[model samples]
Target: MTTIPRISLSGTNYEIGYSHGSSLKAQIARQIEFYYGMFQYSSKLDREGVHSRARDYEATILKLVPNLHQEIVGIAEGAEVDVLDIVALNVRSEIALGEFQDGCTSLSWKVTGEDGKTVQYLAQNWDWVRPVQQNLALVEIQQAEKPTIKMVTEAGIIGKIGYNSASVGVLLNALRAPPTDTTKLPVHVLLRLCLESRTAAEALSQIEKYGAASAQHILLADLSGAQCLELSPIKHHYIYPNSDNFLAHTNHPIENIAIMEPSQFPGSKERLERTYKLVETMSSKNISTKQLREMIFADGENGNFGICAPEDMCKPKWFRTMTLFNIVTCLKDGEPTAEVVFYNGSTDWIDPQNVVTL
Candidate 1:
């Protein structure tokens, strides 16, 4: 009798001082598999449900040739890693959470995989970039349970909206490369991993991941809270939790690093300062997680979007957002239910019941 071999997918789990709870962990693995299948056959995914428009943008990622798998050390499962490496934190810095409470998340940085690392993919999608800037939009992702609306790019992959049973939603933008070594893990996977963590502290634990290569800004929030900060450089990875704020992350050089640490990216620092300013000044009216998405696309006025005066970007501008995304996830009490959302322009939300495959 011959048996098949399974490969291990490496990922880091960070935490302030908590766990993702047992039930949620199991559910996360299942959800990951579901998202993978959906991603692998996204076009069919939307249609299999009810009135689907998957063909609109999801078709791109669904049609994407899985090229990064080549660098991995094992077989594939359309989307590998049927597991989740998570992190948890007890508290965060108010300075960090200040960004979202106000509006906009534009932290930036970079990542570098080690010599013997096995990376899965290296994809960079500037939802605010050219070619597709003409169609900055958002829509609802119809699922069976409830709606987990999202904002998507013309190409998909970039999911920035919707909430699950937890009333928790996030708006993520690529500040830099999301590590694929599995050892260090990808930010998307990590952020999605955070979705599974029950509380803010629980999810922080889900972030303790390996060191590889990557960087970016996460404008995360729930009905109760919101945060925006940079993913610090890998080599000098550190976690700092304080009172007042529950969680706070940034991409610049952390407070305490060895003398030989690398320098922070110039653009990243500027974005951080600007983010602080945006949060401090922006007004809070007609600002739902959905509307803030416009900031990610084309904010005619710099009220929320990353448009206007100093176009903050690395050569790519149009898609750059003060809030270049509109992803939502409907979770109950921070525990993920059957709802998930990914948005771009005016993406609607996805209902929980709809995500289930009959």
Candidate 2:
């Protein structure tokens, strides 16, 4: 029910990291500690091996995005934690899924009002360990020439989900497929790239250029339009909105037509079905922001089948899956203005105006 902390960083990437670490040292430490425990509990690998694997990821990330690498190193020096720990947090999806499984739901739509003006909206619930709530931080990054970016992320992670000054927003959901080389770009990094993009098409190109290390579903929205991207280590797919101008996706792959391997998260289909049915009931025109919030927070029968996921429903307590936060962004045309509502385990939403001017 409390407000999530916010941190602002500007200047070069290294300077940004230094500023982030200096401002949020304690929260960053807590984040690293929590992930270490979660990794140990969920995986068969020992602590030493896990740290080594993190170092391997560090190498891969640096090769993929050297700027992010410098930022992470600066953060490590300022926060006084091992650089590998930060790398582990950035790639936590890959490491955690080595043994544990989790889920998330994303939905986006365009509604036309009676006046004929259309409003674009995207909303999602980031389901993860309840304990991660303590590490949650809203980060605003300002660079020299690149687009200014804002994201809600864990303390040590560079990005998870957020929009940018270009009015481009991204929502992420985990997808399960056969594992590939851990050397490819991680999915979280791809999410960051999407935020850095100026247009939805550019974001899709970024995913195609780098390719994802694991399976993932990325929903990208901008003033122009929105698109859903399905990516695995080896293949990729694109899905457009249905006739209703509505799109909903959970953890599983639903658009795959070619013969391929089965998904590891079969339960995702049920969650997707629930979301689709709920979205179908709403009016295609004039779907207000209030209605979007209600849909994201709605619970199914006995809290069993809805967008909001409870802790008890997460099987094998060690996985720690729960709805950590819900984000709803309304993009306005002709300017970089967006109305964002960030709900952090509370009925009240954080006002974007209060946090950042953009």
Candidate 3:
């Protein structure tokens, strides 16, 4: 089994970034190199154009979230690399999908456990470049006035997926749509904002406020309930749980929104349907965290719709995608705990309790 490194950071935003970059500088360098190759291959763009685009994206990020920009700068300084390289990774998803086309899947639900207690569960399989798995790190960030965050992210990127001490957890899936205004917050930065939120409502408000540059789906869950938002560049659609208190989403937009376009990954529809069916079947019985983890790694008939991506299916020669990691976060006794399975083509999951707190 492969081991994912864990990093702990504290203090102001810059301080946290410096700590994060200094500790993982080598990984950051490799991550940037890998992404540059990806950009070159997928977008067919030359090096000069890629750097120019990264700088433009960096300017947008600075305009929207200046503090995040400071953090990126700190990371570049600490890692002894060009800030544009870090910025490239920060907005890689957008650049990859918009100019190139890339995408992930997530399934979440709130159900009554065997003890008859309402439990919120979220599981995600992050599909991306296989090499990126090496850059993966479990990061815990502590700030003076903001909510402490624990997230699974790439070496230089600020946030991707994770929960906070305030019992707030966020998971995301990529969506495809026509491009819109670039000034809005990118999805990854919005994810960091979600972690900063102390409650589900606050997270929703933050999403509504900044919106997104492209298309993405976010599942925001707290101890009380969970919500899924399908965000296109032009509009946002909100989906609440069904009467059974279950919600699930894949890469595609389920809601009938005008802004949503066809999913780049057609497999997303199958994944979403299979996920919903599995959750519904599991909800009929008493569910446990262990069972939840099993469901994430479940293989469908012939391994078609399984939550875990098969090695052969994850052929880097084609899509440059793989299930880099699987994350399951839950709230127990009003506290957030997370278990992560760093996909190493094996079934090894790590549970670290109390790693994130309010």
The estimated TM-scores of all candidates read 0.39, 0.89, 0.90
Pairs of residues clashing in candidate 2: none
What's the CA RMSD of model 3 in angstroms?
3.0
Kindly indicate the candidate among 2 and 3 with the higher lDDT. Answer: 3
Number of clashing residue pairs, candidate 1 = 103
Q: In model 3, which residue pairs have backbone atoms overlapping below 3 Å?
A: 165-357
Q: Rate the local accuracy (lDDT) of all candidates.
A: 0.30, 0.74, 0.75
How well does candidate 2 score on lDDT at residue 47? 62
Q: Arrange candidates, best lDDT first.
A: 3, 2, 1
Q: Which residue ranges in model 2 land beyond 4 Å of their true spot?
A: 113-116, 257-267, 302-305, 313-317, 335-358
Put down candidate 2 lDDT per residue, 1-358, tens digits, no spaces: 5457888899887898888887879888888877777787777656676788888888888888899889988788778888887788788888866454456788888778445677677777777776677778888898887788988888878877888888898988876555745778888888888888888888888888878887678888897778888877777888888887778888777785331435456357777887777776777877665566565444433253346656654466567576776676676664444333443444344433422322
Residue 161 miss distance in model 2 (angstroms): 1.0
- Candidate 2, residue 126: CA error in Å? 1.3
Residue-pair clashes per prediction, in order, are 103, 0, 1
State the lDDT of candidate 3 residue by residue for 29-132, as single tens digits: 99877778878877776667678888777888898789989899989989999988888888877777744323366766776666787777777777765667
TM-score of candidate 2 to 2 decimals = 0.89
